[model samples]
Target chain A: MEFQSCFDIIGPIMVGPSSSHTAGVVSIGKFIYELLGDYPQETNIVFYDSFAETYQGHGTDKALLGGLLGMNTDDSQIKYALEKAKECGMQYQFEFENICEYMDHPNTTIVTAKRDDHVVTVGGVSLGGGLSKIFMIDDEMVSIRLSAGDDFSILAKPYQRKEKVLVKAI
Target chain B: MMEIQSMKELIEACEREKKSISEMMLMVEAKKSGRDEDTIIRMMEERLIKMKEAVDSGIKDASTAPSGISGGDAVKMSEYVRQGKSLSGDYISNAMSFSLATSENNARMGVIVATPTAGAAGILPGVLFSLHKNDGTPYKELVKGLFTASMLGLVIANRSFISGAAGGCQAEVGSATAMAAGTIVELKGGTPQQVVNATAIAMKSLLGLVCDPVGGLVEVPCIKRNVIGTSIAFSAADMSLAGVESRIPCDEVIEAMYKVGKDMPRTLRETALGGLAMTETGKEVKERLFCRKS
Candidate 1:
């Protein structure tokens, strides 16, 4: 089952509007932040299907940006993430698509980010109730479940890209 | 040690252990998370505190949401309910106002706990607080009621779905309402069988509901639907407590909901492409909002 805990149903106190669109999306973005060891200086985010249709209303853009900046789900600063991104000199762009070529979920996003000399593309899906799954890293398919209370740094360890190995695989 | 996968299994486990639904849930959670019972209870209490904070703040605030489409209704409802002329009595009237308060706060990007999903977050807290206000159900009892709600929600979520994007509003609001109904029954000293029956009754009422948020926002109908869902939960709980049984079993109803959601069109499933989202005024609202943003 995708849902395992009581917290999965009744908890994850968060800045809302939506769980699938905002809270869960934040966890996916935070997963990327942990993967990179910090916030990336640049990001290109593509939202698919339902997320594309309602991103503006649900503040999905702000949620992802807030997570990329290492904000938690309940962080009040999430509402001002767009302005904060601009002030921090983080360059970001958003694209909308009818379908994601990589993931098969309605609430899916693919983010390609660049930090220093490193660039990575990640695909994630928000699976409702502040739960998420990272389905792709670079060109490799992987499965990593992200819950709100997870220690993302430790979760990111096994998937952390080895520069030389990644280059060879690509 | 037995895995409670269906409503039948859940009821059976509760009987076998001579435990209430909430106690069974605590046992299961303690085993799955490897956390102590005290820690789990503390965590749930934290969420309950957050839910109460959202309701308290929203009841007093009259400001509109960022979209300017929803707000101030909670204050209006709270004021009206205070007059004590409500037709639905204290339990349901208080619940409506509380539901409105929580949903309005959610639309404003305020902090709230998701009961299964954020789109349907208002219903449980709405009913729980109303119960507390009407009968003096202690906060600790309400916290246990939350566990009862979570147990029912977990079954529906795994057996069917709980996100609107995945299964339409039937899966979102419908699931939350079902959980609330079961929670109410359990808190009122109903049997586990009665709790599952109440859940079934509530879910059956909203079976074919669609997710059609106008302007692609969770305002407009979403907030109001949460308000009405409270009454449905109360009615279902009362019915089940009176020994009424669902014509169809709870697990079968959940399976049916899953099938219906799978057959639902993409346009009706939170894409804002159909239903009320496609009405004339809906288009106008969408245009106005986007035009202003751009």
Candidate 2:
């Protein structure tokens, strides 16, 4: 196995609270938002596995909502995201599923968001040390990782079959 | 029946393995840096100095620990709530504050995990400190213990999984607890087998621990969870040392944790929409502390 550098794992800048719970959640939300390509008219988030049990305690609700609203991981507004969602007229709901019963990682989230004629569904996992991977998107199934300083809008486009793509955070 | 091995043999093996693995990792790092031995040693020496300073501070904090167990103690009390005994929130809060204060102070010296953010940085360190204190372990052992724990984490990073948003608290606290358990076993002179078993125990116990923080802050239940995670690490180590075997391996345990976390709903995985955050009391606190326009 290839040993990873600390910098490769954690990244440059992060906010308080947690990398997995706070930053990872925001990154996942941002990725979903970018995938939708616009502000979601409504979002239906299902917290599977660990997300279901502890989402409330981890501020993931606000963090993910903030991300859907185009908030950065470090935005302090993430704390008031539920209220912000209400203020912005964004509709969202929370539900718990027995993701654990299927024998999976405890920290998994499946987000499905819909905008005008556009709907995106994805699953994300928040690896510790400020790392995360978008395992699936729109049921097309792709693995995408967003690091610090990454722009999801540009990177979300699927690479052409003939195009050479190297996995490096810019 | 299987033959029982001597504890000294187990300790020596762990020491040798830890030394070799750590040396190998450092060599890899050195190769990547393309730096000479002198520079590498100098850098390592500087890091060692910092770690030593943090350990000194930990000792000082332990020396001045309040009467009764501390924040971790309240968490432990909470575990036994079913026995009809409970601690007041003020007492629990004090313990958590003490743990947080010590961890934040340590972070300044660059010692703790600092996780995805720095404010909750104390959780990992507080857990480590509590484990060592409760076990009557030596300071040097604790330092080496962190190294062992980090090694397990490095392996997980290499192999399958470790993420909170990805895997929930299983990856965060679960990973930390697993690392802590492995490190504690190594500190207690356990063999690799025991270390892995301890790690598996830790991971399994908190397979679905969520990353929820109230008002998007790392305070609230987060502090208590850290304190509790440490105690869990201690028991895991002790149990593994006492010949408890996990039916599942560490890697599989981690994988299960990931799968379980993935299946969890957003409400439980840090959304703050469920659990204590969604309670009447939680809503009241949110309104009182966070509702500025109200």
Candidate 3:
């Protein structure tokens, strides 16, 4: 491709103790929460590959649980999500398994949740460069590949419901 | 007979074209100035023509070498590159000295790329040095390769994010190595096609490489990964120059990387709860380190 005076520089001013571990999981968890349509009394998250391996050390568990608890990407409560999970009375457990078995990427996670009868199983892939894609939801695969720029909603087609509640970015 | 396509050829073409454009503009500007217009135009034309000839010659002589490092080894190597030596080599030794002489009070964040996040930031230098020293390549071409690689990285960032915690090391060391590989190939005078090929090869080879940092730090495995990444990048460049096409396109590989990362269990990505971190050594290291730090 011929170079066309590209001038899009992302400045560094983010709220994060760690951009990848903390913020990324928050985004994925928040996206999952969005897919679920409503808050669940119970959540069972099975972190495949990389997600399960490092969730505790990276605080991904907290990020995911905090996000499900309606926390934003920059929520300070994320540090306390594990302890608070019990206080808030939200039931959750993180497990691990090789989903694809042969692929090289280790940052894949399949989050399945049930809000009463509304069950949602969404697959989120965190491709490097702070970008991620939600590939599936509730057995029905969602083609929500994360592209450059803000196309979050457009990618969330399968998750869209009449009563879908959109949470504001934090 | 028509000339074969090569990276050197393409870059030289672009350079020649750029020179021609510059010369033409200079002539137009000189004409507007209304003095010594013919002299200025002639000089610019001559310069442009010389550049074109050089580009043509450079394209005819490009060879490459393949990387032998494995997917995991690449990551380890990248980490090693980051931790600069106490003293050695031209580029890094100087950079290391400068880093040491400079006080931490006024230090800035160095984008280590696929290198070690801290301690050593010499992977790029190492890759560039190897390309220049081992391949007998010119310095200017290296700059162009770096520029091209940066552009590719921007595209990836535009398309997706490269955070290790978010996307695992595939985003961190993985993307950085890919970026480095693309640059290396470009420097080797590979075609844009080869540049893309090198990128895919690097990314594909490093697909699923985890960010299992021991003791929850960017040290250890992280530093080693940087060294490996630089080596892999060099190898990728060589492979591309040798006409090895990475069957998958870079974009698709990137997408697949994302998909595969999504399927990865959280343990391996940087939570320090999987892989080596989960091992006995990892646990002991973490216990000792965290206890000391706290």
DockQ of each: 0.88, 0.14, 0.07
Residue B143 deviation, candidate 2, in Å?
Answer: 4.9
For candidate 3, what is the interface RMSD?
11.5
- By summed lDDT, the worst window of 10 consecutive residues in model 2 chain A runs over A161-170
lDDT of 1 by residue, A13-125 (tens): 89989999999999988988888888989999999999999999999999999999999999999999999989989999999999988878899999998877778899999
What TM-score would each prediction reach against the true structure? 0.98, 0.54, 0.48
Which digits, one per residue and each the tens of the lDDT, describe model 3 over residues B17-121? Answer: 553212323333354435475554443333223322222222232221011111232223224445743234433332222222111100111121211112122
Evaluate candidate 1 by giving its C-alpha RMSD to the native, one decimal. Answer: 1.4
Query: What is the C-alpha lDDT profile of model 1 across B1-294, one tens digit per residue?
Result: 446789999998999899999999999999989899999999999999999999999999999999999999999998988987789999999999999999999999999999988889999999999999999999999999999999999999888999999999999999999999999999999999999999999999999899999988989789999999999999999999999999999999999999999999999999999999999999999999999999
What is the descending DockQ order? 1, 2, 3
For candidate 2, the lDDT comes to: 0.57
Flag regions of model 2 displaced more than 4 Å: A1-3, A6-15, A20-127, A132-170, B1-24, B31-98, B102-112, B115-120, B127-143, B157-161
RMSD of 3: 14.4
Flag regions of model 1 displaced more than 4 Å: A161-170
Candidate 3 residues A1-170, lDDT tens each? 11111111121111222334444456677676665654556887777655654444446677678767766653446667777778877788677786643234556777777666566677776553334567666555554644223344444544666224422221
Clash number for every model? Answer: 0, 65, 66
